[model samples]
Target: MDPGGRVNIFVDTFAWFTDPAHYTGSNAVQVRVFEHLELSALAVLIAAAIALPIGLYLGHTGRLAFIALNVANVGRALPSLALLAFALPIAFSLGLGLGFWPTLISLIPLALPPIMTNAYVGIRGVDRDVIEAARGMGLSEPGILRTVEAPLALPLILSGLRTASVNVVATATLGALVAGGGLGRYIVDGLALQEYDRLFAGALLVATLAILVEVAFGRFEARAVSPGLRSPADAL
Candidate 1:
């Protein structure tokens, strides 16, 4: 398309967003935004559930620390697209089809590294003197980990979750590659039909969603964190 045509198409697409016709159906941008957030939320929840406990245990025990570190590094090093492609066949063979399961599985890896690394690093970064002080107070190991270590590590842990959430939300756009749905629907369909208008719209929505997620989390982190731990910038 010519520059003028592309510009016109972009304007037209932005205009479409304000039209009720574009948002009243199941496939509307409004609906797709919900679907996209649902997938991203599920992926983040699953990754956090799987990664956090192991990371905390390893960090606290000082055993199998290498394994926890390696798991995070491996997750970081893996390619998200390649991971999706590789899982597709196995998921298909298992009758999972080309939909939610396969796509979410791909996003898990994209999310795991940050959560795992942050959990481990956060816990380990807890001062040993503090741990000793807790122990001296007759705190059990579990008590120390729960009350002393975890609280102190909360900031880094949150930072990790934020990173994973952002990555998963952004990469969730790739769901369209395997017949899955999300905000990526617009981008995929636009590209197939040479609709630069809808393509730019989808890109805009995805970027906006990511920024919103970051801001929401930043606010939550600020509130959830203890006043003593709040940095100057994070202080309300």
Candidate 2:
């Protein structure tokens, strides 16, 4: 409300993080952090698995161009909280119970768009001249994709992974709203009990995790890009 109150929340958040009591139990900060990572990782992995193949195949063949481009748009059109809310009823009717499944399902969409779109765009963005060169060298369709296109597309594909990872990490906070675990628990419970420090601490943790993922992926993408493709089409 006031400047003093905001300052107090900051001070209290620092204290909350330093308190040993928050680090040793089932509900410890480390435990919640792990759960948060676990949920985010699984959702991203699943989304990638589903999106990558489809995106790559469509991009390689240059087929279904409309679907490839539009699917991500559709996913983005849906809100994360709305998706989570929509998932709850179906999860119950399917006997999946609460917590993990619904949250996981909702997070998958949050991750899907960037990954699928990037994969599609990256592959399509690969120099057509390169693809023709691969074909001229007697490389088959799969070989062209594996040896030429995918390698060239690596930086962008990894960019997608980076985006998806950060997104999932940030949005997985919604899991707590559905009785799931994670740092989000701190946010939800803190707000419920009017413990502003815990709320701030949770928000800080989510932001930190998201930033770490962004940095890690950025470095990995740099090292992971194909060396020859590092230059412009002039070399091609």
**CA lDDT of each prediction against the hidden true structure:** 0.89, 0.90
- The model with the greatest TM-score is 2
Tens digits of per-residue lDDT for model 2 on 101-174?
A: 89999999888888888888999999899799889989999999888888888888999889999989999999
Candidate 1 stretches with Cα past 4 Å from truth are: 1-6, 231-236
Backbone atom clashes (below 3 Å) for every candidate: 0, 0
Candidate 2 positional error at 52, Å: 0.2
RMSD of 2: 2.2
Instruction: Point to the candidate with the largest lDDT.
Output: 2
Q: Model 2, which residues run further than 4 Å from truth?
A: 231-236
